[model samples]
Target: MSKIQAKDVNGVRVLILNRPEKRNAIDLEMYTQLTEYLIQGNSDNDIRAFMIQGQADCFTAGNDLTDFLKHTDIDPQHPAFRFLFTLLDITKPIVAAVAGAAVGIGTTLLLHCDLVYADKSAKFQLPFVHLALVPEAASSLLLAQTVGPKKAAELLLLGDSFDAETANKLNLINDILPSDSLFDFALDQATKLASLPPQALQASRRLMRGNIDGIRLQMHAELEEFSTRLKSDEAKTRFHAFLNKKSHKPT
Candidate 1:
């Protein structure tokens, strides 16, 4: 089955992350596909807006650790980097529907979306520090700007999960809704955006995002540190422990 499913709805392109069994953990292939889809959506005149979502139970559990560990060197050309850069460069309006766990990049990517809606049960986390790594996707800079430096430090440093209420309070998510209703609501909002004047909407979006050149620089810096950290002994030990724990879980 396809891990990333794309569909067009009322000029709104909906990309569904469909690996529910793995909690939609993003692997290398998914990264590549996501980047490709975003690039296509941006250039396609028929596609007015984009909405990214996952299964009702999970938005994403973040990177697939096994696949992530297999890639030693992460450069600008890497699929993960391509995805982040594409997300930053996309001029179209983007909306996100988040539920359950939005961990690591799952949470960070929402920072770039024009609008975000989360379910009451949604949990957002950036546990890069716990894995002996630093934040990626320019989240270190964007999160700080969104929630202030101190709260950003508390979230990134402590690497704890925050509920939807906290996410809304920090202005990370626009609103919280019932799990069953979140996806439809986000899609409705995307349709509304799609109905707007495309040129004006994109212009306004670009204005709101401001100068993303600084964000690009931050992403490059974060990728450099993240790649270096991934090769460290601490990271290896943590990855092994995490995999081992998963292996021991009851089937």
Candidate 2:
């Protein structure tokens, strides 16, 4: 079965992350699938908006470390980077419903979303620093811009997990909803966007996002350092430790 599944409701394209076994940890194939779906959805006139969600217990555990470690190159055209870049260029509005864990790019991806709703069970974290790495998805720039440098520093530097309430307080999410109703609520919002005037909505969204060029530059800067750090001894050691921890976990 496909790790990423898509369904159309009215004019909204709903993308479901379906790797519950892996806690929906995105791999290279999943990234490619996501990029293709988003690009296809944006161009299809029948699809006006998008909604991204995962299983009741997880939004995503972040990337698949085994798969990520296998890739020595981290260029702009890399599948993971392509997915992030696709998020930046998508014209249609994207809404996200997050529950359980949203780690690393899982949380950063929310920054590019137009609306985000999380359940009380949701947990957000940026553990790049903990892994001896820098931020990606232009999160270093956007997070600082959204919540100010001080709070951004607190979250990124400490690399700690935070709850849904804190995410709402930081304006990272629109609001927290009951876990049972979270998916329906987020889908409703996306459907509402699909019901609006597409041109006007797209124009308003673009105006609000301001300079795309600046965001692109920030992503490039982050990727350059991210690639370098991926090669470092500290990062390699942490990666090995993480793999070991996972291997020893009681199932």
Candidate 3:
């Protein structure tokens, strides 16, 4: 079965991260596939909106550490960067349904979504600092804009996991729901968006977002810093330590 699954429901194109065995951790191929699906959905007139979700137990554990460690050539054209840019460029309304762990990019990517629903059990974290790297997905700027600079610093610098209540309070998520109903609620919200007048919806969305050029600039800046940090000796040490720890864990 495909690690990333795409289907249309109620005019909403649903993209599911399907690698449950890996906690839906994204790899290069998954990033490529996701970007392609988003591009296809954005161009398809019949698809009015998009919804992203994972299995009931996990939204995503973030990037697959093994895959990330193997990819040394980080650049603007990298698949991960491509995915981030594609997500940022997508014009249609995007909704995210999050449950369980949403680590690293999993949490940051929600900033690009129009609406985000999380289960009460959902855990969100930005562990770039823990990995001895920096934030990506324009999160350094955007998170500060969303939750003020002090809180953003705490989140990024501390690299601690937070619960859904904290996420909602930080404005990262629209609401928190029961774990069993999170996906359905998010999909329903997406369907509602799909049913709205397209031009007006898109126009309002664009207006609400405001200053795309600024966001693009911030993203590029973040990418540059992130790429540089990824190559640092500290990051290499942390990555090796993390991988070794994972390898020794009981299955």
Best candidate according to lDDT? 2
Per-candidate TM-score against the hidden true structure: 0.98, 0.99, 0.98
Each model's lDDT = 0.94, 0.96, 0.93
lDDT of 1 at 246: 97
Residue-wise lDDT of candidate 2 within 142-240, one digit each (tens)?
A: 999998999999999998999999999999999999989999999999999999999999999999999899999999999999999988999999999
Q: Write the per-residue lDDT of candidate 1 for residues 62-93, one digit (tens) a residue.
A: 99999988996999888888899999999999
TM-score of 3: 0.98
Clash pairs, candidate 3, are none
Rank order (by lDDT, best first): 2, 1, 3
Tens digits of per-residue lDDT, candidate 3, 23-138, equal 99999999999999999999999999999998888999999878877896788789999999998899999999998989999999999999999998799999999998889999
Q: What's model 1's TM-score?
A: 0.98
Best by TM-score: 2
Error of 2 at 34 (Å): 0.2
Q: Which 10 consecutive positions of candidate 3 have the poorest summed lDDT?
A: 68-77
- Minimum summed lDDT over a 10-residue window in model 2 is located at 63-72
Minimal lDDT window, size 10, model 1: 72-81
RMSD of each: 0.7, 0.6, 0.8
Runs off by more than 4 Å, candidate 3: none
